[model samples]
Target: MKIEAHEVERRVETFKAAVQEAGLKLTHQRLEVFRELASSADHPDAHGIYDSVKHRLPTVSLDTVYRTLRTLSDLGLINMLGTAGESIRFDANTRKHHHFVCVNCGLVRDFENEELSALQVQEDLVGFGRVLETQIEVRGICNDCRNKS
Candidate 1:
């Protein structure tokens, strides 16, 4: 998606509001960390986030990244995912979407099939509660990785 600068600013404000709503203090470091996650197309892990921001913030610690990731995930600002025996990664997009994980490289990519969401679940399947989130994570080797093998 081609996000405009104005949109980025708007999102920043939205994030701040969310933080405030959660009774959290808005700090510069937190904003920077949250912005990176919100703006990134890649759903990177804590390590990836630390690596990306380390250049700008020489003194930023890994602990800060981990804490921010947890806070953001709790605030519904990002989605966190983890594969079997793999590190957790974050997705900035908050809209209902699914993911496709490349087992070969452990890369997580967004995959949306409208038909899946359009389908209705059986009443018996969810007897007591309503569906709040419907995210699917499919694991397989990516085409590029498969071709390389």
Candidate 2:
């Protein structure tokens, strides 16, 4: 889940552009929040992000972080994973991929399978509307946690 330095710069620029396109000012708080997310492989919740950003920008509030995350998600700058138990995690990689969530440790890692990515969901299958995106979450014990047992 480690992002290359070049990729991190690219992501930040892309996110900034998206925000500008949405008629929003690229505030300092938003930039710091984006940088924290761009540098983390571990998907973090709003509080986690706020905590990290607060180290550098001590005046930042948790509410501002939450609102910034929501804005980024709304603009498709990042992905909001609200299904990972009660905590909502945020992912910087918006590309097509799935997640393998460790039930014991609550670790979420990206998993990309060509077959899964190419899957086409028929609307009749679920009697639902069109599928804009597809993400599969597999819950199980991670190797690290299993080894500790």
Best by TM-score: 2
Residue 84's lDDT in candidate 2: 32
User: What is the C-alpha local distance difference test score of candidate 1?
Assistant: 0.77
For model 2 the local lDDT of residue 30 reads: 88
Cα lDDT of all candidates, in order? 0.77, 0.86
Q: Tens-digit lDDT track for model 1 on 1-149?
A: 23357656777888888888889888878888877776665687899889878887888999989988898888787778766576788876665567787788876666678876565665455567776656677889988899999
Q: For model 2, how does the per-residue alpha-carbon lDDT over 1-149 read when each residue is reduced to its tens digit? A: 46789878888988888888889889898899998998787889999999889999888899989988998888888998876347788988776889998989888888789898887877564766677867788999999999999
Which ranges of candidate 2 are over 4 A from the true structure?
A: none
List TM-scores for all candidates, in order.
0.78, 0.89
By summed lDDT, the worst window of 10 consecutive residues in model 2 runs over 122-131
In candidate 1, residue 49 scores what lDDT? 84
Q: After superposition, how far is residue 146 of candidate 2 from its true place, in Å?
A: 1.2
**Model 1, 94: alpha-carbon shift in Å?**
0.5
Q: After superposition, how far is residue 45 of candidate 1 from its true place, in Å?
A: 1.2
Name the regions of candidate 1 deviating beyond 4 angstroms.
1-13, 122-131
